[model samples]
Target chain A: MILTVTLNAALDITYHVPRLQPHTTHRVGEVVERPGGKGLNVARVLAALGHDTVATGLVGGRTGEALRAHLAAAAPGVVDALVPVGGETRRTIAVVDGESGDATMFNEPGPTVSAQEWAHFQDAYRELLIDAHVVALCGSLPPGLPVGSYAELVRTARSAGVHVLLDTSGEPLRRGIAARPDVIKPNAEELARLTGLTEPLRAAHEARRRGAYAVVASNGPQGLLAVTDEGTWRAAPPARFEGNPTGAGDAAVAGLLSALVEGLPWPERLARAAALSAATVLAPAAGEFDGAAYERLLPQIDTLP
Target chain B: MILTVTLNAALDITYHVPRLQPHTTHRVGEVVERPGGKGLNVARVLAALGHDTVATGLVGGRTGEALRAHLAAAAPGVVDALVPVGGETRRTIAVVDGESGDATMFNEPGPTVSAQEWAHFQDAYRELLIDAHVVALCGSLPPGLPVGSYAELVRTARSAGVHVLLDTSGEPLRRGIAARPDVIKPNAEELARLTGLTEPLRAAHEARRRGAYAVVASNGPQGLLAVTDEGTWRAAPPARFEGNPTGAGDAAVAGLLSALVEGLPWPERLARAAALSAATVLAPAAGEFDGAAYERLLPQIDTLP
Candidate 1:
């Protein structure tokens, strides 16, 4: 089983407006809602790709109930092990303008996890890890949890003999990498922030040297660059797909994990990650990839050493 | 007892952001949620002013549950007679810019109400009206409900010998006015839309001639103008108070209804309404009046024939 943890899960709502004007009233059309957070997004894609996935996190209040209900109805394949907490789960709204096709996002700071809840989550994480082959610690820590929350999870996964993938930014990411997780997936900007290098190859190398076993840097339309102990490779799609790029990184993480579990070579794993990431851009909704696009793009992806 | 009907109730969410920019992500600060609709706002104000207020309307799903929970916790003074339905209630978000102090609003189109649910609501409305002295039909009709929903409610209240106040806009307001409710409150724009007269006094008179027993026009900053069978009056505050005008009209409606229940004369009713409306503007949150300001401004309000 593949386990994914989202410390701060959200009920993602998308409001479609004809045109967005600042400080004016808008009658929104088509309100679309889904369960969201980086780990959950990755778990969703993995489930869609025919992998056994379990999701764990802290959720509370009515908003938390709503998120759980959505997950049960929409992603039945992914198992729910989310624990209850005190505060209401926060909501993230994307106001998508129909005219300009631009989305203005407003993210509410998530519910604060109590000290008791954090201790309880650590116990639950260990229990879930008992049956898992791989685990992905994803997204930011909700307030009240220590900044080393992801680092703690990484250590737990390592002790359980599970290959953990750390996907987060800022202090959590900085601290988590020191635990020497199997893989760290950071986009180009995040890579620059961590390693202070503009070039992707050098940045990934620097990140690995800082204790990440492998570094997978997503370069938006350009695709994935990987620096692993086995080898270094660059994977690029034949064409750039134009659509919403909201959950492309999560798709890449799912692809990399799936390929790793299948015991594929480094080149094949990089190719799969690049194809899934690009296909996700073509898909209309977040956390979903176009299967047909993925199939076509996969065979044509150029992986160079 | 005063009964307020919110046919389309909402979970009003306010997000405070440092600044609002088009197509950019905002980390929102201070998320505030309240149960809202025009009638609900009036009911809250009436309860705050020590009146026995009952709020009735359609609510459903998880969002409805959240709204009810909030109403229970916050407005314990107001009685809850909200009827349950199958569809989820909607949410309206106000993104307030901290820098400019301007709010950008986004309203979700409420859940589609089945005909069976509409029939159930009418039954509930009639049952509640039996012990009520006054009923205020407020706000827009949700999808799948008849356009003349308010008209039906007006007739039901009138048949129960209950004084009815119609507070809505466009076609619902037009159809509701024909039911000959005891009072109809319209802002300057709503009055113009109803009577095709730009002038407030003329529009108020025209609206009364159409079917309302009395017409109260809320003129922003300038205050209240009333055209009734017994008399015509204009009520204005000593000075214009600057703040949010979101629920000013609802405060005016609450003041008028409270005064009517007390058997106050038309001039006194207009004065109370104007003072409450101005105080509401000075209050930080919607549907709340600054008590100190209301008391100071009430004695200074100038009412002229």
Candidate 2:
């Protein structure tokens, strides 16, 4: 079982408009709503790829209810989310122009989680991690939560003999890496912010020295770079494609966690992660990956040091 | 008794931010949620002013539930909204910059009202208008409904011996006036759009000549103009004050309906409407009129031919 923790969940709403002109009225052509947040996105992709996953987070208000309902309707058996009370879940509105494929996003500041809500979430997470083979901490912390919240959670999961993966940015990532999670996934920008290094290889190495067993840095179309205890390796997809790249990082996290749970070798995990991420960019909507595309690209993905 | 109908009601969400920069993330300082839609706004102001009013509209999904909860919590015993199945009510996000008093509004396309939902709403509106002295058909029509939807509604209320006030725009206003509603309130822009006359007096006169008993055209800080069978007049507020002007038009409609329900003279009704509209602009948030400010301005409002 894979347990993914999304501390700040969101009700992601995508509105298809012909075009977006700021400060003007627009008539949306279509609206699609889904449950969102980094951890939830990774969990959803894993579930869609035939992995059993449980998503836990603090959810409140009507937006939270809508998020849970959307998740249930999307993947009933594979996805289970625990909702906590206090503030309404935040919402992210993406105004996508179907013709141009450009998107303008307006994100609402999600509800602030009270002290009691964080305690409740931690308790639920501890219980869920008991049976989990792999645990992933994803996304930003809600307000009122200590910056070291992810670090504390990672340490707890490790104590329970669970393989933990940390994927975040800024201070949380810096603090969580110090606790030495088994794996950390950071995009190039976040990697730079964390290690103060522009070169991908140097930054990955710096991250590994800080206690991460493996540091995977995604460089968009340039593919994935992993610095592990074994050695540094680069994996690239067989071809480049164009589509919505919003959730590609989450797809990579899902791929890595799924392979780790299945006991795949480091090289195989890196290849699979790159393949899944490339396939995700080909999907029409955000956070959705094409399983058939992943299958087609798997054998051709190139992993090189 | 006043009954207000909002065919496309909304969960109005206002996010207070210091300033708005396109494509950048902002941490909102405050968030306020209210039950909105022109008719709903009108009803809220009427209830605050001590009028007996009922607000009916088409509501669905979780957003609809939240709208009802907000109305119930804010102005208890004043809201009686009828819910219809099929589509969730829409949400309007107002990104307000407090310093500049400017708001960037993103209005969601409201729920598509199926034929069944429209039938249900019509039945509810008829029942609510039975004992009502004035029936206000306000705001835009939901998708899938004809442009003359408000016209049909106004005719229905008039047939039941209820004085109908139509407040909408474009085709709805153009057709609704032909139904000979007792009163029609269109802002300067809407009036120009309806009559193709940029001159306010000419627009109001043309609207009244087109079967409407009276035409009330609100001209923002310039105040209001009215052309009635009895006479034609313009009313200006004593002073111009700066605040959110989002719902001032709806507040004017509420003031007009309040005086009409009390059998006040047309000039008095027009004066109250202008005063309340300005008072609404003085309120910190949209859809609320400051009672003290309204009272202060009422006595000083000037009416001219």
Native-referenced TM-scores of chain A, all candidate models: 0.98, 0.97
Top DockQ hit: 1
Q: Per-prediction TM-score, please?
A: 0.99, 0.96
**Model 1 chain A: ten consecutive residues of lowest lDDT:** A280-289
Q: Give per-residue CA lDDT, model 1, range A222-303, as digits (tens).
A: 9889999999999999987889898999989999999989989999999999999999999977668999999999999999
Where is model 1 chain B poorest over a 10-residue stretch in terms of lDDT? B280-289
Which segments of candidate 1 are over 4 A away from where they belong? none
User: What lDDT tens digits, residue by residue, belong to model 1 across residues B183-217?
Assistant: 99999999999999999888898898889999999
Q: Place model 2 in a CAPRI quality band.
A: medium
All candidates' lDDT scores? Answer: 0.92, 0.86
Q: What share of the true interface contacts does candidate 1 keep?
A: 0.94
Clashes of each: 0, 0
In angstroms, give how far residue A255 of model 1 lies from its true place. 0.4
- State the local distance difference test value for candidate 1: 0.92
